[model samples]
Target: MTITFVHLESVHHKLSKASHKADPFSDARESGLDIRYATISDAFPLDHDRDLHREKYWTTLLQIFPSYVDEFVRKLIRSDPQSLHFLVADTVYVWPTAIARKYNLINVSFFTSPAHVFSLLYHLDLLKERGHFLRKDDAVDIDYVPGVGSMRIRDLMASLSKRSDITGNTLFKAFEEVKKADFILHNTVEELESDTLSALNKYQPNYAVGPINLSEASSVAVSRSLHAEVDITKWLGSKPAGSVLYVSFGSVVQTSKEVIGEIAHGLRLSEVNFIWVARAHLTSSGDSNVLPDGFVEEVGDRGLIVPWCDQISVLSNPAVGVFFDALWVEFGGREHVVRRSDDLFPSDLRSADGQEVGGW
Candidate 1:
């Protein structure tokens, strides 16, 4: 199969290419797939004059996407690669799927999250029709997502749970596009999301392609340094095997200084050894000041804070006991205690109606 990827030639796209430097496509050409890149200069250009509004940005992208993908595919076919056996793209850009249909090619749309999240997004329009999209003050905050378990309003994608017009509108656009794709690629594995995957109907055949656990040296696992103050490798090595807790909240989630302080206080109170990968952009002051006052003194060599480091390498270190994508929700003015997955989801949802939501 010749797998062609049609994408924008943007800086972020270049970075993603760098991340996938070890292209299985190039290597696996003899194995099965003959890969091709059909890229254009910044297909969805952003505004330089002002900050881009999310809703306007996505709407504009969608408006322009069909024509762009149509041209890209037609040109590729004219060049004669025997027609694209498979065309893949981010689910957010559904134009490729439409192009695939025109050219009689298989379209695989990628979702870079879990099957449960994908399921929620897939049924978002239906939820809206059923009047279940958002909570009314008169109504309860709890609702059952089709494939996923009982979802608390606080637990919904921060966008849908809140009254964010931009995110909700853009999200609706993205998922609506997803439904038209012939195939969906989820970033989670089958066992972890077996029930949710099963719930995907015949309309769109889905695959559990990842939860892509790559090694530090894996071609796809490239790292760029942000904070170089402390040596994370040396720090993790100093601790005992499986003794240190690793805390990081990923890139998108903006965490407050007060919450980080609370985490520091909790770590101090627990008196545990831990490595905290604190990204500067996530903090209020964009510095280690996010740590609570007297935190460094109190923890006293038990904690190591860095702006950024190779998370994969840190997790691979024998000293890492647990790696948590920590989340802290604010409610009732004060910050509610941060909960790990193990704390919140102790059991799976009932599998009735083929709806398997573990921890539902």
Candidate 2:
């Protein structure tokens, strides 16, 4: 059966470029799955200033795009009643399952964040009831989480507040929708989060079919093509194992000059070889030169700071010992949380039979 993947145009543009370079559809085609991308931009003009317009433009976009989404669904339903629809992630799949149910579309939801993070958000009401809503300091110890070690309240708080701001008060709506999906796919590995995955399996059919990072398997040609001028993978190949610290905070998160300076200081204190991708205009303050004076000279050849670089290529490199970024606490909190190598690749890397394997 064919599958139609519907996503926001802004996201699709990036993914289509990546997918074309990666040729992900070729694998699907080889497996007899006809895949196509349907984007909102195909149906309506996008407001580049959607955030500025706020609810007015948001409602306008929804009204305009639902028909486009519905039409795509209708075409898929007509082409093959059994055609499946995959939504990339919670943020992109803003429509209701009722719409899919009306069209008889087999809707599956994908979550790019860790499952434990979702579970925490799913129980946000409970956390709030227990006096965990907003805090002045950005850090707090989060206990009672399933499958994984404790998370700082600051990290949890940031996610919760940010979700509320972006999606309004219904924080659990996405997780609730995910549970009702035909199936759920997580961009994580079972071994990396076996405990959390086990807990999630009790509620729904969930698959931890990731690190979902294609960069690890990407060819040098694809990497160079995607990144344009900078060939990070080739440069990383020359570095020693566990020498470089890869730094990135996805595409959306922003950091201030003070926080950026702190991070630079922290990295210098850590004394690790690093590649820092400092995107321009990260803050309106325009104090992008947040690094400590003589910091680069101190590290010498041990550090490289570029304005932008391909993240996946950097993360997969053997030289990358840690991935560091400043954590923002939107609500209130003083403590910052960092994800260590162990967190990404959990310690219990062996299977039940004691065979050496890679994963959770």
Candidate 3:
């Protein structure tokens, strides 16, 4: 079967001219996989700083993205109508179901997060019925969501805990569209989230087959990273086991200067040797002054702060103490939570083979 990976390039994945010139699927070609790759324009300039104007950026995207999807689908089907059988897309897009219907394609929605999170968003009506949608009371218990245990609304995802913001509303609407999808695929492990996945399958065909990033590619290396990656393997090898902390807020989520300062200060106080991926555009202001004043000099050689690094490589290193990013599950580590800072190191961490490691 031929698989075409159509990447919709947005601010999160603004392509550099060099990257645009490079063949992104050379590995797939070398591996003899019948895969095709294409990059679709998100109608934003390559140099546009979306973070500097986030609200306007997202609002405009919502207005224009659907038309682009429609045109793309129309042209592709006209080119070879019978060749296309399935429309697989990220669940965040609000137009997949409609476009699939227009083309008579079987729509499959892919939710990158765990099934538990997907279940919460999929049951948006249930939240509204239980007074949890747009809920401001963070302390209230959210016990009614199917397959999810009782947790405070405070523990709920920020998108649901806070008042419906532009992005939150987009996600809510996207999930609503996702319900109409012919199939739902989750990036979660069934063994780990059996109950949650089982619950979701009752409404639609839900499949658990992810944390796919950890999977080894067949025969060739194909990199899809949007940022330049620095190698920290040598530096990490020098640190003692269970002595370093891996700090990152992920690629797209931007925080305020205040939050960056707080984390920086906490790292200094804790005296934990660390590697922090302070990616470009990490702050809403898009300024380079993300770390606190004199932070580098104060921490000196104890910390390695770079614009980006190979995260899975860093996490796999034996010297790293704990994984602090809430975005990805811990692969190896004794769980440790710093309650004062409300940081959690996930417990019962396992490697790809399901073997437990002593530390991250």
All candidates: TM-score: 0.70, 0.71, 0.88
Cα RMSD (Å) between model 1 and the true structure? 7.0
For candidate 3, which ten residues in a row score worst on lDDT?
Answer: 329-338
Off by over 4 Å in 3: 9-21, 162-164, 326-339, 342-360
Instruction: Note the Cα lDDT for every prediction shown.
Output: 0.61, 0.57, 0.74
Model 1, 104-202: lDDT tens per residue? 877778888778877887877666776766753323454556568865554555566554555456666778777877788888888989888888855
The local distance difference test score of model 3 is 0.74
lDDT of 3 by residue, 270-346 (tens): 66688988888888788976888899999988799998877888877888866667443111111212223323322
Encode model 2's per-residue lDDT on 1-360: one tens digit a residue.
455555566555555464454443445555555675455663434435433334454555445665666666676667765535443445234565756678665567777777766566555665677676654343567676555467665555454655444443334555556656777778887887888888767777788878755534322222222222346776677777766667765454555565566666666665556787766555435455667788888878767877667666677677776665433323232234232322322333343477633221
> How large is the C-alpha RMSD of every model relative to the true structure?
7.0, 6.9, 4.8
State the local distance difference test value for candidate 1.
Answer: 0.61
Estimate the lDDT of model 2: 0.57
- Candidate 2, which segments miss by more than 4 Å at Cα? 12-33, 42-67, 82-92, 135-142, 148-152, 155-157, 162-164, 167-172, 214-229, 284-300, 325-360
Clashes of each: 6, 10, 0
